[model samples]
Target: MVWKPDWVASKDILRRMGWSVVETTMMNSNPPEIEVPLGNFVKMNILFWNCRGALNVDFKRRIFEMVINHHPSIMVITETRVGGDRAARIIEDLPFDGSIVTETIGYAGSLWLLWKTDDVDVMLLSSFEQEIHATVKVHNSDPIWLISTIYARPRLSERRILWDSLKAVAQLHNLPWLMLGDFNEVLSSEDKFGGNQVSLNRTLQFKECSDVCNMLDLGFTGSKYTWTNRRPIFDLILERIDRYFANPSWRILFPEAAMTHLPRTCSNHCPILVELLGSTPPGPNKPFCFHTMWLLHPGFPNIVQEAWTEDGDLQGAILEFVSKAKHWNYNVFGNLFAKKKRVLARINGAQKSLASRPSEFLLTLEKQLIEEYFFNFTPGRGILGTEVKIECSYVWRP
Candidate 1:
């Protein structure tokens, strides 16, 4: 929910009055466009890390708290060295209602999905190349084709197999899809800070994978890379191997979503934070006034009292005052509240326009607003201290 200055004042007042306003911001302005109402727009956090085989109690608790603080609608983790059973035990202890784990022994297996059961509807259709890919339906929305994780092999031939598997899944679902995780292969030279010496085979394999999936590579945000090697000369050397890909649909909800490189934990690679725009909520009707400060005028009380004496109702009195008030500003507040009604009508019309469009388009517009307007809308930046970053597409190529 967008926090306005008035809302902050209201919150402060409520706190002073000893009222606990647990929910300060509403999730969405209007209901989901689907036939049924999904409680609200879901908030999700996709985390990618190579957790170097350590899952202590303290570590588990810290991770749990981190997830809770973010309050993601869905969560996905990668490079979990632990087997599925052990991962399940850790996840089971958390507050989330459901989790799906897929693990392979030693070399390159990963955990795919861990989501809140109440918000998502899961239908296990078929496995893709023995990977745990699923067709998931979100509340009151169309199904989202999802694959938990992808572990690209070091060898070109093996990577080709993985690519084919992904293609098979895409053909099977034939819907909007997002396949994400520790891909382990950098697509271009820009992906790695200083890895020009590394063989081009892996990069070529990554390009092939992208081509087969018909995917657009959304690059990382904060840091140049996620993975790191130990050699001092190349000590801080990092590579943007971990990534995410979306078909047309997933991009709708999050056109601006990008990977943020987080501080490293027990893993060699820093965790990646994929951020998306939250949905807007329908707002209350704008307040009406005959003049900006009409209520503060000394003559208003007597006029209101006389109107009430005649009409015996608050609304009727207000109507009478509007009709009788001399030199009233129609532009600010019309005699018939027609302007207020028109504003409300405009809001309704915008909502209808949003609802009729495809979910992807609506989501893209929302992302543009957040990145361009909302996130950058800082005080002291623009009018009312809000600024919007207008440029739409930004890319760093190698």
Candidate 2:
């Protein structure tokens, strides 16, 4: 239980403000003494991949690469195309300590939910041919959430069954629910390229199901397309069928949760890594520096006005305003630094895609992101820095 002087002061302040603090054990500490809010202190990584087939000779190596790089507490591999003793043997050699397997239907959809028992407790709730639902409780944490790993069947008729099953599961409990996998269906035309346009009729069922379940798409960080058909330039087909969706409850639980589309290797579908960072170590405390961007928020004036008191204690009023303004900036206007990081990530992903394929859509997206970065981060600068333009690629200088 390492306690800093500042943390001690914070604990006293929180207790005085009627906030409950608990000495919960975190993954980083052996016998935890850190006092945090009375809730889950989760900070774990999850990796989901549609491995297409897991029987290849180098499959174990690929899994090792992902595990070594991401160190995920939970991992889901869909479309294994293997079952029975063969599947068990494959999982046996993997890095995780616990595992659950949903056998394939004659070389079709299968799901392997693997987890580190040392880091998390996963209770198998339901397992179907196309999906595996589990209650995940991070070790030494009070939060318990439901996680569903799905692999919707390739055919439209079969996918309807998957959607219906999910709806039924969604009704079981109102816990923070997270569903992720290869849906084998696109939600919009923007989710695909070099293929027949995705018609509304094709997307209507999935959209309806999502709306009924109140699911929000947890946007990804890397290339928009997650799967590709390995073909020549003229016939190449790409689609972002694999994704993560969470209910509003789950989003509120982990607002900083983000998913990254990893580079495609050993499979057509790119691996998606989801990060839930809840118990990260606090940074150094610095004097408050007012941000110019807060002026852009419509609610800033209201927050200042509310913080101002009728009493003639100028020091107290200034302190109150600072506290209220910081809270508003966080909960309403959002953390500008975090937003800037996401924007830069999107820009990097777009630039990478353009470097490989040079698509008009990606080029335009990169240009827009560049303008946003310059306008928000650079003081006294125009949106495009200085006359930004896109020829075959984006050209900008600050």
Candidate 3:
């Protein structure tokens, strides 16, 4: 006997699965400024999926479950395979505050971009048949980046147009940019496990386009293949077609950013997650080491001189200098290492919240923390970690 679950039973099943339905709250047009406390990181989660069909009951259930469990700030669904009033009905049932649906061409292709305005501000920049471009600004954060959610055509010749169009978009802006969804093309032979080997010419063409656009694939964890034909073993094919790519600037802005492949349930394409600062693993604590950048500060010499004059012997004076220098570093230049640690701790906290339902306020808080880290630690200095050893002490490279 085939059994079906009702609304309450469905909720019970979700609760048993360790997910709870989050209550929706109305947000004010002008909310109060969010205070970003040390060690409190907000979460920024973007989910992408190509759900083959949108009107199916299974699709609706899976999408709802994902939203309640993952709490993504933004979501993009491709290959919806339905449009017009039919698409509107499914979209109305979605949990997001806002949505943009690109009408499909007679059951062929459609794209849906949905977001919650309380935590994020998404401004539509432009839209094409195969792609939708937008500017996403996480609330309480200053960094404004570009997002291109795509679903390229299956035909090789048609895909060429996609590559050119994407390249054109890249040229039009200098903003930190990210692209996600199914490109329907593999980068290399390693990305394909079965079926006819990917053509070398196609790979090179894609590579050339990426090089011109200065976009690099954001590497992923979990299953290597993201799409499957699901045919018999003798005729099965698997490929890593869906992915996330970002420019160097975006990568630097979210240094701890990561991508995860979710299990394929309601679709042939595995859902993908882009996390700005994923969970951080704890590590051994390091002893306090003096930074050479302190020397660059105008007040460093005065602090050392003042501390040295009040001391008795050479040993006493050296100890006094260390203490005074530390005090000065904290009060004046700000203890960057301590700040970094706090930011990382907050990022870990936000990542942990991903398993449960997080409020929109928490999402804004996460973005605020990320912006603080980016501006504080690496402003003007290319990227963060560069150190060398000298007499049992580590110092930043000039």
Query: Considering every candidate listed, which one attains the maximal TM-score?
Result: 2
Return whichever of 1 and 2 wins on lDDT: 2
Q: On a 0 to 100 scale, what is the lDDT of residue 152 in model 2?
A: 92
lDDT measured at residue 69 in model 2 versus the true structure, 0 to 100: 50
- For model 1, the run of ten residues with the poorest summed lDDT: 383-392
Off-target runs (Cα >4 Å) in candidate 3 are 1-42, 280-398
Which residue pairs show collisions in model 2? Answer: none
Model 2: ten consecutive residues of lowest lDDT: 383-392
Worst 10 residues of 3 by lDDT: 21-30
**lDDT tens string, model 2, 1-398?**
12233335444543443223121212223333433223344788999999888987657766765775567999999999988899898899988889999988987778999999999998876688888887788887776677989999988888999888887655444567899999999999878878688879869999988887889999977777888775544666888899999987778777888888875645778899998872244457534535555565577778777867687366666667667867876786467656655776786677558536856576567667866775655545531111111221222111
* TM-score for predicted model 3 compared with the true structure: 0.60
Clashing pairs in 3: 42-365, 42-366
Model 1: per-residue Cα lDDT over 148-218, one tens digit each = 45656456676677776676444332345677766767777766654456668767766776777777666
Scored by lDDT, model 2 comes in at 0.73
- Each model's TM-score? 0.54, 0.63, 0.60
